[model samples]
Target: MATTEMPNWFVTQFNKRAQHIYQAKGNRLKGTVAGADRIEANEAKWRLVGKGEAKEFQRGQAATPANTGRGIVGAPLKTFQFFDEVHDYDSDRAADPNGAQEKEKIFEQGGMALGRSADREIMNVLNTGAATAGNNFIDLGTTAFDAAAAMTMCQRLQAADVPWEGQVYCPLPSLLWNQLLSAKVVNSSDHVGQDLPFVKSTDTRFWNGVNWFLLSDSFFPVPAANKFDVFLYHKEAVGHAPHTELKTYWTWLNKFTCWEVNMLSKGANVLLQQEGIVRLRAPSNTAITLN
Candidate 1:
């Protein structure tokens, strides 16, 4: 078979494998936020409408029209791509018997690389949202995260009128998760009954009217040594726009005599509402050892 003539089945399988890995490893925040797909051009625009209050109406009174705020928010999509070159010798070697292991390596690596990049970009967007959260940003000083802190986070959102009945989420690092487990209110059955962290034996659980999920330490950016930020927000508070989903392409380079496999995606993560997001600054190095 010619280098350029890859069968349709091969292409389909390659894409399926890469996409599976990408979905499994990339963008832990995928469905947790709002999304706009098939975006036209580089920017995706979302329509924002402000809340309006009702006033007491007198009998036969003329309707009073108030201007409720509304605007267009745009998220700029950026391209993220990863490519690998397979030399003719490597391709020939892969075609040999007992060489099946090498064939899928490139696709796996490409998927993982692109997935990590997507997650990194999402984390950056969270940081940006946190920076601009204004009054919603909370600093816990150097103290560890506890049930009180979690309650405070939930209360802040509730006070701001952000719905908390299955709509709030707190994504934190394992360090903070450990500290939270140390809190008597989280691990003790007396405080939480069967829903206790230790009783549930799960990394993710619903507590204090928020769905808390644990993210790997690598995804979060370290502002300073042993310091990181935890984001608690409503799902509608953030937005993700995808100009293109993960795509893979293969091309034969005549001059280089190599096959270039390229994987890429285009998307943007943006803050949709400041009122619905709360950023908690906490120490990242704190953990509690279980007895």
Candidate 2:
């Protein structure tokens, strides 16, 4: 039997190709153009009717409808203005000859799905402990990464004060043998399941239509009130505008990855300027942290 070792020329060629893919992913997320506001033109401004005779003589009334000025939407900039610009690559060179050769294939394979893996990374930052639960890590925050914690926390979000019911998920989607496992969950985020854009459809054709590629803006955690019926484009969906502050969020996955985003909730809206602060009411007292 003859052994066939891979050539160095092929490895170098593949590495370059893999790197270019990252740029392509960034371009896709940095949508073609920023969208304009979608609010009604009239509701932005209202004219006051003057009292008694002042109202009757509306032509001369200072606060009448005639004097109403052109009003802009309550800050159109808030709609997912995702302006994240990135051009970083792993500067660390491959040391082992085997790693260098094997990684070329692995990188391509992983990068093909890196978009979704990256999406998983973003959520992992929110629930770091759960991300590593399969590895046998004990707990997350005060609660163990068990069914009880996810269920209790999920219900709390559904309550009146912090009314939110977001779908929880396991660390990885494709790796887990969903066929092998009992197709039911007791009470974990994965038990309830998070809904990807086209996840529910049963068409096994094009990934763009149904397959899960690791696009930057493809996966995200949206609150109930924030969830909409329509599936907007990723750029418009996540608000990743060029040269925006939001694009400069913390990188939880790899410290060097620019794909990470702001982890805190701001004001009553997730958009707008990063308020970076959240108020949580616990059994003992309230806890505030800047995301």
Candidate 3:
């Protein structure tokens, strides 16, 4: 029988190497992994953590205005730490996974991540995930994401066996992106990430109209890829939310990796048949106009 061998130095060596790697990538990590609250000052976290109980006086007599107001003191400022796990979709983007995790070394536990693509694509996605607080590593419960399942979601939408003019194929509905964050299906390493919503969820704004797709936009359209254009529901935008709220949502939504499009509507979906919609005949590369 052969004897198995184990080394005691493994853990120590791994920790040392990891620390070195993090120090090397600290600056780049700041941009992607550290949330605004963490990198910037977090007043909310500070006040909550530092709050102390009020002192009660002897009798039920409240005399001075200062007593009525109660002596209030602010808590000591806190240094927010983002030791979050992020799954990267594409490794080529600026904040790649391996690089980002390496930067995490400066944090308390030395952050780590799981990624879905080659080393190059993995690094970038890591960088993006570290970019925010709400963002985290979300799989479809399982690491595997079925594209066929996504397509089936579209094909299965018919009633009484009706074959329609259009269809939508989406990945796991739970993993479908709401904005910048995504539970990307990795290992396949597919770069194409346009998943039109096949069936409407609780979200009320996006629906398939008889002729075209209905879009209930949160705010101003996002910057689309060269292959696609942003569909602005201007009327819906005005009716849905006030201008100030829309502006805030727009800034955040633009950073999202997901782009949701309503499948062909009964009255308004023939925009695909238009002459220039196929390619960029317009001035902007993001030429997704309805007309």
Candidate 4:
């Protein structure tokens, strides 16, 4: 294992700067999905409880409820590393005493790199989970979303007996959101009666019983030109666990200094009851129109 002889304050600032950039990317999805179970790894094995069956009861008869089991699984905690090397003798810092600022900036960028890495992992689990949701996937065909279509989706969830109390999120692409706007189906308070200039937003809006979260185009998986995967799920439908937030190390040699940062997280997104999540194949991309 490698070690560092850096000062306590310097290490503290490094971690602080790293977490600032790292958390922004992490919280993008972490803050949204609701119920996630967590477990620590020992000897490279971990287990999470899977969803159990629920059945109707008889009024006056003996019954046997189905047995439940944990989803015994072993997924290595993912690690991401970012590093930079600075040559002490052949660098600007070699002559300037004020070069410490540049060094800190380099560390900050390293932190942001780790943050973006975490963002990819978050998206990975979400996309994979939604894709393999089996019967939970609802195909909207080539038709763009409208008020009636959105309401019918809610009814499907209701039929599945998914809890209706908490917020259900619908993560959709920006272009699909425009379809909603053009159809006059979505309008938030900020967009009400404001004469302000048209500024693009990736904000969430309330419509029907679901909160529609507009994500960047890159965040979605667009397998076809006219279709994109969108998920409408309760917090309980997905899970996320971070075994390690961010661990960093710095080392100095005779001529060059080395630095590295890493993070470990486990994904339990697809284990929840499929009824709580509904994947939709919606019309998307640049050519989308109401006609």
Instruction: State every prediction's TM-score relative to the real structure.
Output: 0.84, 0.25, 0.17, 0.71
Going through the candidates in the order shown, the clash numbers are 0, 13, 33, 2
What lDDT tens digits, residue by residue, belong to model 4 across residues 22-113? 56533455555543334545222335555477778889877875666666444445666666665554445422445556556666677656
The candidate with the higher TM-score, 2 or 4, is: 4
lDDT of 2 by residue, 1-291 (tens): 232333455445654665555334323222211233433332211122222323455565566454433333232222122222221233123334433444444444444443333333333323221222222222232221222333343333223132122221122122112211222343123333224433332111121111112222234332233220111111211222222211112222334432222211111111211111111111211132211
Off by over 4 Å in 4: 1-4, 34-38, 42-63, 66-76, 86-108, 131-135, 146-148, 190-202, 257-270, 286-291
TM-score, candidate number 2 = 0.25
lDDT of 1 by residue, 54-109 (tens): 98999999988766788878877899999888776775643344443444788889
Model 2, runs deviating above 4 Å: 1-144, 160-291
lDDT of every predicted structure (CA atoms): 0.73, 0.27, 0.22, 0.58
Report lDDT (Cα) of residue 247, candidate 3: 7
Error of 3 at 243 (Å): 37
TM-score of 1: 0.84
lDDT of 4 at 83: 65
